[model samples]
Target chain A: MHRTLHPLTSLCFILFFFVIALFGAPTTQMVGVMILLSAASSIRKRKQAWKKIALYILPIGILLFLVNSAFGAPFSRGLAYALRFVLLITPLVIVLLGGSPTDFRLGLRTVPIPSRLHYLFIFSFEIIQSLRDVFQAVYIGQQLRGYNANRSLGNKWKNIFPLLLPVMLIAISQGLDRSLAFEFKGIESPAEKIYLRTLTLSPFDKLSIAILLLSSLGLIVASFILP
Target chain B: MITIKDLSFRYKQEARNSFEHISLHLQDGQALGVIGPSQAGKTTFAYALAGLLQKHFRGGSLTGTVIFDAQDQAPGTSEIGFVFQDASLQLSGVTETVEEEIAFSLEQFGVPRDIMRERIEEQLSTFHLIGLRYRHPKTLSGGETQMLAIASEAAKHPRLFILDEPTQALDADHVRHLIDFLRVAKRSSTIIFIEQNMSATFELCNHVLFLENGRQQFLGTPHDLLNSNIDVSSLTLPELIDVQRSLGRNHISLLFKETIEWMKKCRTSA
Candidate 1:
C-alpha cells in the first residue's frame, strides 16, 4: 500500500503530521495520534528502517528526558516530553526512509515551487548521502591503517582533522564533477521537462489523502476534547 | 565537421596556460584520439571541444574558435555528450534505478515520454544493462557503472561524443565491449577519444593529436603520427610498434592484427 501511494499523497500525509506535531497540544492523545500515523507510514518499511528511526529518536529522547529531569521537572512530565519528541520526529524519518529522491522530485513538480529550488533540495539529500558514504570509506581506511579513534578521547579529537581533510577535498572535487555532469545532461535547459513516469491520483492515492484529512480533523477535535 | 583553431586556456590565478596553440579538424563521423602524459591538458582540451571551457569555466581565460558544423545549424552544448573519466561522478545521483539514470537527461531535454521509453530501452539493451534495469545505479559494480555512464550519454545520441580516458578503470572484458561500442558509435557521432592505451587509440581512431607540456606536438593520421619524430616514449606504445621502431621498420602496420598478418607473410615468404 505504501508503495502504491503517489508521492503527492505521501507528502500530503507528511505535511499533515508535521503541522499537528507543531501546533497541537502536547498531550498523550496527540502523541498517540502521531504514533498511529508513523506506524501507518512505516507499515511497508523494513526492519532496518525501523531500527534507523529508533536510532534517530532514542538518543535525543534520552537526552531530552535527562535534561528535563535535571531541571527539576516531574518524572511523568519529563517522560511525556520525551515521548512527544519521539512521536513528532518518527513520521518524518519514516517518510524520508521510505521514499527516494526521485519520489521527492516527482512530488515537487506539482507544486509551484521554483525548479531550481526543488532541484537543490533533492540534490542536498543526495550529496549528504554520498558524503556519508565517502566519510565511512575514509574512516574505515584510517582504521585499517591503525589510526584508531577509539583509543582515547584525545586521540578521537586528534583524528578529526586528518579524517576530514581528505573528505573535504574529495567533496569539493566531486561537487564540481557533479555540476558538470548535470550541465552535460541539460538539467537547466529552458525546455519544459517531461517525466518518464507521470504522477496521477489513483483511487488509492485519493483514498489516502481523504483518510489523512479525516484523521487530522479527528485528531484536532480529540485534542480539544481530551484532558 | 569540428574545427578548433589557436585554442588555449588558463585557469584563473594560474601563471601559465593549461594547453596552448592546439588546432585540429575532424570530418563528420570520424574519431580523433588525444594522447599525452599527465598534466598534458588532455581533459582541458576535451572540455574546450565540448564548449564547456567557455560555458562553465567562467573564472578561466580561453581563446579559441571551436566550430561544430553539424548537419543541423550551429550546434549548442546539447549536441555534444561528454563522459568524464570517473564513472561514479558522472552518474546523476538523483536517480534510483538504472533505467531512471538513462532517462534523466532525456527528461531534461523534454523528450516525449514514449520516445524516452524507447531510447531508455534501446540504451539499456545496447549497453547490456537490461538485466540490471531495476537495480539501483549505486549498487552496480565499477564496470557496470561505467557502462551505465556511457549508456546514459549515448542515449542522447548527440552529434559528438567526448570520452575522457573511458577505459582507465575498465578490465579487459569491459575494454573489449567499449571498443565494440565505439566502433559502432563512430559511424554516427564524431568522437574525441582521450586515452592512455596506444593500441585502442590506434585501432579506433583515424586521426591522432599528441599533446606534451601544453603543446600540440603532433596532429595527423595514426600512420603519420608513428612516422613523425615526436617522442612518444611516455605513452604505452603497442609491443609491435615498439619492436618496429627498434628494428627501424617504419612500414609496420599500426594495427596489431595487420602486423600479425604481415609477420605471417614474412615467415611464409622466407
Candidate 2:
C-alpha cells in the first residue's frame, strides 16, 4: 500500500495518526489506534517495525513510569503517561519503516513550501538514513573486533564512545561530500525544478485519504464527547 | 579550452599547500589524466578544476585562475560535471530508483519532460542500467553504484567533466564500458580524468599531469611521462611498460596490439 498509494495520501494517513496520538484522549481509542497501526505494519510484512517500536517504547516507557511513580503519581496516571510515549512514537516509526526520503519529499512538494525548505527536509531524512546505516556498520565492526557491547552493561556503556566517534566523523565527512555532490548535480540551480515521475491521486489513494479523514474527525469528536 | 595558471591551494590550518604552482592548457574535447601517489593532491587538483576548491572548502585559500573557454565563470553556472571517487557519496539520496537518480540532475536543470525522458533512456541504455532501472539506488552494488553515478552525470553532457578515480570500483567489463563512454565523452567535452590505473590513463588521455608532494612533477603526454627520466617508481606502471623497461627497450608502445606485435618479433628472432 505504501508503494502504490499516492505520497499525499500516505502523508495524510501519517498526519492523521499523529494528530490522534497527540490530542486524542488516553483511552482505549489510543490503544486501539496503536494496535491498528501495528497490525497494518504486520499486514504490510514490516515484521520488524513493531519490534523496533517496542524496543524504543519499552525502556523509555518504563523510565517514564518509574519517574512518575517516584513523583507520587497514581499507578494509573503513571501508566497513562507511559502509554502516551508509546502513542507518540509509533506513528513516527511506522512512517520511517514504510517511507523513504523520496516519499517525504514528494509528499512535501504538494504543499506550498519553498524548494530550499523542501531540500532541508529531504536532506535531514537522508542524513538520518545514512547515519543509521553507518551506525549499523560500525557496530558490526566493533562486534567482530571483540568489543562486544552486549556482553555486559558495563561493556555496553564503555562501547558507546568507540562507536560514536567514528560515526560522527564519518557522518561529517559524508555530509560534506553530499553537499559537493549536490553542487555537482546542480541541485540548487536557478531553473525551476520539474518531476519526471509526477504524482497523481488514484481511486484507492482518494479512498484511503477519505477514510483517514473521517476516522480522524470521528476520533476528535469522540474524544470531546467521551468521559 | 580549459586553462589553469599557477593554481595553488592550502587547506585550513595546513602547514603546506595541497598542490601548488600547477599550470596546464587543454584544448576543447581533450582529456587530461592526473596521476599521483597517495596524498599527492590529485583529488585537490580535480576539485580545483571543477571550481569547487573555493566554494566547497570553506576557509581554504585558493590562488590562481581556472578559466573555462577564457572566462572565469562562477561555480555551478557552467556545465561542469564532477564524479567523485567514492561513488556512494555521489548519490543524491533524495532519489529512490536508478532512473529517478538519472533524472534528478536533469530536473534540477529544468529540462522539459520529453527531453528529460530521452536523456534518461539514453543514459540507462548507455550505462547498461536498463535492467536495474527500478531498483533503489541504495541497493545497488559498488560497481553498479559507480556506473549510476557516472551515468547520472553523463546524462547532463556537461562541457567539462572532472572524474576522480571513476573506475576504482568498476570491474573489468564495466571499466571497458566506462572507457568507451569516456572515449565518446571527450569528443565534445573537456575531461579532467584523475586515475591510478595507468592503462586507463594511457588509453583515454592525450595529456598527462603528474603530481607529487603538492607539486607538479611532469605534465605532458602519457608516452613522455613513461619515457622521461623523471621518477615514476611511486606509480604502478602498466605491465607492458614494466616489461619494456626490463627488456632494455627504450621505445615504449602505447597500444597493446603494437606491444604484442613487438613481443612476437622479439620471440621469433630469439
Misplaced by over 4 Å in model 1 are: A1-3, A15-42, A46-87, A93-105, A137-150, A210-227, B70-74, B261-270
Q: Candidate 2 lDDT, tens digit per residue, B8-78?
A: 99999999999999998899889999999999999998888777777778799999988877878743633
lDDT at position A210, candidate 1: 88
Q: TM-scores, in order shown?
A: 0.85, 0.81
Q: Specify the poorest-scoring 10-residue window by lDDT in model 1 chain B.
A: B70-79
DockQ of each model vs. true complex:
0.72, 0.58
Model 2, which residues run further than 4 Å from truth?
A1-105, A140-150, A201-227, B74-78, B267-270
Interface RMSD of each: 1.2, 1.6
lDDT by residue for model 2 over A14-115, one digit each (tens)?
677666765576676356555656545653547767677567767897898788878677887777777777766766666666765555566666567677
- For lDDT, the strongest prediction is 2
**iRMSD (Å) of candidate 2?**
1.6
Please give the TM-score of chain B in predicted model 2.
Answer: 0.96
- Candidate 2 chain A has its poorest 10 consecutive residues by lDDT at A36-45
